[model samples]
Target: MLDRSSARDEVVRLTRDLVRIRSINPPGDELPAAELLAQRLKGFGFETEVVEVAKNRANVVAVLRGRGDGPALMFNGHLDVVPPGDLSTWSRDPFAGDVADGKIYGRGSSDMKGGVASMSVAGGLLAASGEKMKGDLIITAVSGEESDSIGTRHYVERNTLDGIGGIVIPESTSLELVIAEKGTIWLEVNTYGKTAHSTQLEIGINAIEHMVATLHEIKSKWESIGYAKDPYLSPPTINIATIVGGVKTNSIPDRCTATIDLRPVPSQEHPKIIRAMQEAVDGMKGKLKGFRGEIKVINERLPFATDPSSDFVKMAQALGPSTLGLPLDPPFGVNFFTDAAIFATKRSIPTIILGPGEYDLRRNIYLGHQPNEYVKIENLEKATRFYYELSRSFLK
Candidate 1:
């Protein structure tokens, strides 16, 4: 077995290779990364296939068959990452994939490129050792995670969930296993009104003003929805992410729109959220002049929850305190969403969210989409071992 420190070095090298690909989500130039991973897995004698759902987006799944009787395990991670924002904030080149001061600095280092590396390393190590196991190992590197997660959602909905026992999303877990993730609801609110001159405000309705009122109502009512709670996560959170109104300051804009993102816990019903927004908007119409508005609610994603006592969660937990020398704690819920939600909600497969990165190392904290983004090397190293041991617990 490789020592923890050396194992980290190997993972760092793999992560550097992956981050260098720059598979940013919008463009999702993940073909190279997916092909690279597929080739590596093929070299390891695993059955691999590439599925291209959309332009510039593809998902890769590799399977290493083991003893037929044991349960199969799936290791999943996303190759796509949010774009690196602002160049000046980073100490090193965001795409350089450089290793310095015992840290690998680059975009997608923590959010998930590091995870892809750990999965690759774990699969590769198991192959190199020629280990015999009771069940098969299926590794999937997917795309479009940062966007609507169409790649994963499509795979789950359209394909057969055959020959797979359980799934682990190698998200940043700070060396802990994440067993549950919060669900997401995204809606775009459009407040419509007639345009008028700034001075003659009474002649025409001010849509921007009406929209602002609607937004406030949404904020207030969203809080009062009496959403259910979980002990592990903070109360359900809501944010008015984007707002836009009149093109210029002088005119009373005829239209104003605001985008709202709601992170609902498992207890919150998705349809109820949409209904509440409708009620909020209807109430706003009565309060403002000509309160004509439209609410477009889309299923951004379904909330994902897993039974903590399941064998899969318990099996991963077994390694945390024993072989990996990490604390064993019941998995908690996370406010930020991930692809795992699809497995638990759509497929009825219990999904866990834990990975290697911690809260402090979050890329968004460093303005992930805004600048030179990177993840710590030590953290990636720690996670690689977790993946290895987590994989081994199932077999030889």
Candidate 2:
């Protein structure tokens, strides 16, 4: 029999402890947290490995082995959190791991050291029970999910997923099941020109002006391209994420750069989009004088979806309601992408995103990457139990 109370306490403690560690992503320092998790899993008799992918950036892989016959299940969560933007906006210290009003308040409490702690505790409890499962339980605490998925990409390159049957990403899904997610394409466009005195406007080509024209042409061309609507996800979209131009106000700008974020449905081809962008640049070059522009793909990940009727998805739907005491509503999709976009899509494994924290922006429950982020203690405990039950049933 599983000790639910003990498991809940362990999860709460672990969540608080993990939140206290500063694993902010810009610096991508996850080594301390990775070491802590490795120590915890080793204490539970798990075979654990901590690999440093970069300086102060690391990934932890822990496995509880079972009989060799059954399929393995992998649980993944990131150790890094987005930086707490403005401290004054927060009611408490973001790294204090403060607990009040039934919530654990911290930068990553919801998005999502809470989920990480729950999954770690669930795996620990499973190992403690000595249940003799036929399959292995693997837990990965990775870094760099906030910026680029460097740690996961490194893991994928280093390991093979031949025997791993399924994956679970404990992202903040509010304990709801997510069958699909959008893909990401980050493209950087640069426009170059000759610098001259601002008074001598005729002598210099303004790169900023060229960039404006390029952006307009690109948007028009991209919008003209049609795509079939996806039932699970919203229409594909694009946004100008960042812009950098001009060194000073006195001189004509010599160069300008902008990064575009494109979210695509699973049916859209990444290469085709790249081609379209290049075409837009070519069109601009013909229309504008000295419109020297280049396009570079910074990073990309495919949209991921698991068939609703897949056996693994069906199993999750069947077990979720009973385990979490919430009705398993019709499957839905998330707008944001996850590490699943790489791990699950690359391995062709059935996967689901289900975990604690509220992600519904319509309800104003944006606990992720916002001021005063927190995870309800109750939700943390419930998530731990659900992961435990789901892992046990799947392994059986």
The best candidate by TM-score is: 2
Clashing pairs in 1: 85-370, 85-371, 86-370, 173-355, 173-356, 178-353, 178-354
lDDT (tens digit, per residue) of candidate 2 on 299-373: 888889889888888888888777787765577787788899888545788988988976762343556999999
Kindly list the per-residue Cα lDDT of model 1 for residues 1-396, writing each as its tens digit: 444445666788778888889898788888888888887678767889988878867889898879877777788889888877666767778788887777677888777888788777777777666778888888888888888777788678876766667787877666565666677888899988888777887887888889888988989888888866676666888989888889777888999888888988878887888898889998986798788998887656777777778877887777777645666466666667788876665567756666654453223232235455566776676566667777787655
Poorly placed runs, candidate 1 (over 4 Å): 1-9, 361-373, 376-378
Q: Count the backbone clashes (under 3 Å) in each candidate.
A: 7, 0
The ten-residue window of minimal lDDT in model 1 covers 360-369
Error of 1 at 138 (Å): 1.3
Q: Look at candidate 1 and tell me the lDDT of residue 119.
A: 76
Model 2 TM-score is 0.96
